[model samples]
Target: MMPLIADLRNPAMRDRHWKQLMEEVNKQFDPHADSFTLELVLDLGLEHHQEAIAALSQAAAKELSIEEALSKIENLWETLPLDLAEYKGDYLKLRSVDDVYSALEDNAVALSTMKASRYAVAFLSTLDTWERALSHISETVEMLMNVQRKWMYLESIFVGSEDIRKQLPTESSIFDAVNAAYCKTMRELQDAGTAYKGTMAEGVLDGLNTMDEKLDKIQKSLDEYLETKRQAFPRFYFLSNDDLLEILGQARDPLAVQPHVRKCFEGIKSLEMKEVGKEGRKVHEAVGLNTPDKEQVPLASSVICAGAVEAWLLGIENAMCTTMAQLLFKCYADMKKTKRERWIKEWAGQLSLCSGQVAWTVECTKALHAMSEGQKTAMRQARKKQTTLLTKLCDMVRGNLGALDRKKVVNILTVEVHSRDTLDRMVKANCASVNDFEWLLQLRFYWEAGTDRCLVRQTNTT
Candidate 1:
């Protein structure tokens, strides 16, 4: 046994010992020998072979263990497990020679009487199991290493640089910087998910979901903050509901009310400009906007505040457009009513004067013709001045009647004259001569549904 052990320690001696043992076994075993004796000898030889193989396996395992220990000390296999769990159970179940030898010995005795072919088959089967087990261990180690590397990469993304770290949400705030960073990271993670499939994809998706949760929380906080700001600065945030209601109530003619509403809008715009300018100046001063690299430098808080202000400004502008549409309609109604009344009174006074001149001319045509050349020139000048005044008044009235419907004008005229008969009588009484009657008829049509050209023709004929 000692010699066998000593021989087993050396390569050449071990081979020679195995050769000599086989020779002795062949010499000892004969076809004439009893079956029990042959079986016992074969079993003994098989047991020794198992013991030698076990010793070799132990030495190899010890060397691998020492190497693994050194590797651990160097931190070379940091993510790898230090246990033999992958090799345990069905594949290479026993860790030591004693246990393996005992287990094999029990099976070896039963297989001692079996054919050599059967024994060879069993040995090959065990080797195959060990080979598959080793392959599994290799794959598992690689997977663990990949997972560890991915974990480190994910952690680095959050704390890689000062700027990056600053972008992450702290306990107090989750405004511009954090929001921007979250958006950027979310996009990167989505890209990574597409780039890395299978196992790595799982990790990437997990990280993305985590980031999404954080962003969701930050968004909720930001929304709350913005709401508070809107409440605190109502004028800057939105148009007042009461003012909008008032404008709606007053609107009568949508087409004619625009000019008045536009005036209001201009006033609101001026106020917004002043407020934005004032707030922007304060923000600039606070964030050192005079710095040479101000564009590059991210003034996160100031930028966030400015964004809120700008959003509010946009909201108010939209509201004004909507509100003024309604308010302009109201202004158009009021202006049209006032202007129509004033125009009627002025036209009546002018008509009375022109009629008086026509009546005078009709009653004293011969007397006027009999006057001196200078008197005739004075009378002609007076009539020309009156005609010019009438033309100017007609132009003013036409301009003030912008887009007013013909039906509305007729209704207003009917109300003013009390009756159609009264209006006809007035027209007849105003016409003192042929030209005067023509001018008066033109004035009636102009007030009803006629264009400025009608009055132009009347003045030309005069």
Candidate 2:
């Protein structure tokens, strides 16, 4: 007569209520029953649970379809810089040795009126433009190599993942259809990657080789010019005034006379007369004896102007060469540093994305298996409990019910106690273990942290 304590209408509470009712029935009718009949009743519930598990497995398998896998691969492929036309255009713009030769010819004519030192300075200044052009070519070559290496690495990843996707079983007609489409797209991407490598070799590499040859020729010419200037300029500084005058007076080469006279006057004027009066008197004697006319002193002044021009030219040339050498060396050092840092950063990011995708797929597969195993365990426990309840019921009904009536009663009770839909829902809800999800999250964190540490270490080393 007491009101029912548990709500049988609630799906969540129905199993408990049913178990309590069956226990009461056993205590009232019979207290010692065998479990063979109970085992048969629970077998029916196990069959229903098995059908639910199959449905869940099929759903999990569909989640890793070819379409999703291809999408990830395509995203990685798109990151490659495969514009061969841009590389070709940039390579063509580098200045050739012929261009540097033409510039030197023009500069030489402009510097002809200046002294040897001035000519050297002007020539050295001209080398700066060539140095810049050459440095640009070097940087471009480095960039191209980096791009080629990056593309090759990405291509390998795409090809490897494609193979994995292909090996996965085709669970349905839809999977087969999607896989066929994915294969076609992957092949096109592979072909494109191959073409990019060919383009790099044919265009950028060839261009770099040509630039290097031209630069070497130009550098050799500059070195020879520098040596000639070094020998010629020192003569103007150390030559005796009388010897320079004799050379100018005899002047077998008319073109060389003015330069010798200029050197003579420069030697006399540059003397530290107070510091070395003996040299100063000799310089005075040479000028006085050679100059029969006072007007010739002004001619000597003109020669001194020529020497000043040479000094000016050489000073500028030496400074420009030093500045340019330092500049180019700095540029090379900076380029290397930048390339190394960029390589590490980009490689780490790409590797992280790749490994993260693989890990996610593996985790999904593991979770699926875990869920299936958990469901089996739950079903086994359910079967054992049902068998025990049925055994109790059999003992209670022995005297009151005949064999056929007892079988009918057991079938009715089993149906009332186990709801197939409710068991299906419970198995689905409880199948994915919380512990598994937590473990997966922890693994993902470690992977990301490790990637970050690797990047930091590489950056510090650089």
lDDT of each: 0.35, 0.35
RMSD of each: 25.7, 52.5
Best by TM-score: 1
Model 2 Cα lDDT, one tens digit per residue, 314-352? 443344344333433333334345542232222222232
TM-score of 2: 0.18
Give one digit per residue, the lDDT tens place, for model 1 in 109-148.
4233322332233245543443343344344334433333
User: What TM-score should be assigned to candidate 1?
Assistant: 0.21
Candidate 1 error regions (>4 Å):
1-202, 233-400, 403-462
Name the lDDT value of residue 383 in candidate 2: 35
lDDT of 1: 0.35
In model 2, what are the clashing residue pairs, if there are any? 29-396, 30-396, 117-310, 117-313, 117-314, 118-313, 121-317, 262-303
